[model samples]
Target: MFIRNESFYSFRRQYPIITILVAIHLILFVWMNFLPFGNYIRALGIGYNLAVANGEYWRLITPIFMHIGAGHVLFNSFSLVIFGPALERMLGKFKFILVYLITGIIANIATFYLGGLAYPPHLGASGAIFGLLGMYVYLVINRKDLIDRMNSQLVMTIIIIGLVMTFVNPNINILAHLFGLIAGAALAPLFLIGAKPYYAEQRVFVDHGEPVFDPNRWQKKRRNNKRLKQAFWIGLGILVLFGLLSRVL
Candidate 1:
């Protein structure tokens, strides 16, 4: 009910990364629970600290798609729907994807090293979800004039509730959430600048019957679409290199 029609109509078009992410999560969840290969998929994707320590470093990334049960995936998917599209619209698809992946992997890494090797191998996308929430919090704080103060306050409330939930769920890896939030905050400077000039000006307008960030910022420095693209590839490369190193060393 809170989502605007324009935003909803343009969600898939403007936020393809969010769509792809939700699709992947749903597909994996369904494949793991309904299909004959469910167990195999779970075995391959679920994170296990010992497995990671043994050089199965893919665990760092794969667990973002793994869930313990219906409740887990449902909660995460709902959170994504609420937060992902807006962030994607602001950061553009490529940069948003990079933020997601970087924070998520870092969260999992934190879990691996600090989660105390508990049972069940800590899985799910809560860390990444928290990352988006953290990013939103960052934006709300740094770009206060650009965002509605009321909305920012609401997000702050939700973040606090989310954090509390992290603690309430004994099965949840609080470290992952904490680290992911920290990573999102640290990485915000790389992404808070929009790919379009409107992003800098915090303006919006209709473009070819669709809405986009202000294209009339009037400053050449305000429009830098390459920043997100470049950051995406660079961050991806770093994650890949780190994963490989985790496996080798």
Candidate 2:
């Protein structure tokens, strides 16, 4: 069955977080290109050396926003436009935003650490987008029954496309993609496991055309509270461990 235009619009409207992220990415893609040393730094992201040595450490994260060309930006922006809204709708705004930013940062960190800090600058949100794809695959596989009757082959096609793009595109950071995928797959279960109550409440609101249950909002708030507590201790432990390692190593 064809998805109606109204339905698509409704999805976009309901998931403003994704819209805002996509918009920001597009703007940065254009703006970064005009900055001094932007092109040079982006090439380093692919595997250049001189570009990295110029104190372009921020290139790691900046590259996520910098696209090589119009074609590159279009491809990524299109994917985000299509997949991001649906994921945001399923995960809720807060959790979806969390997954996007955290996995992106972790992916960049992993790339830097594993690729070696000296191994040229890298760029592109592909790592994070790949993470989103990984999460989508997890959800689809876990909920096979729900998608079985539809065009499930589309998922397989998308995965194959991603694989091919990873190999054919010289600028792509394969290691970052792999690490981000793992991170996303791991985190997806955490958010998806207890989502049924939220989904049920969402259905009630959608069908009734009125604000009824808000289990999703409540669940998100509770989860954030727990995560904040965990983060505080985790941060403290990391600082202490780092200090010890510095002194000993």
Best by TM-score: 1
Query: Which regions in candidate 1 have their CA more than 4 angstroms from the true location?
Result: 1-9, 117-119, 195-249
TM-score of each: 0.75, 0.65
Q: Which stretches of candidate 2 lie over 4 Å from their true place?
A: 1-12, 34-60, 145-151, 196-249
Quick one: best lDDT, which candidate? 1
Give me candidate 1's TM-score against the actual structure.
0.75
> Which ten-residue region of model 1 has the weakest summed lDDT?
240-249
Global local distance difference test of model 1:
0.71
lDDT of 1 by residue, 1-249 (tens): 113234655766766787778888889989998999899989987888888888899989999878757666766776787667667767777788999999999999888877756635777888887888787777777876445544565567667766765665456678889999988888887798743322343345565665566545555333333443453444345334433432333
Residue 114's lDDT in candidate 1: 74
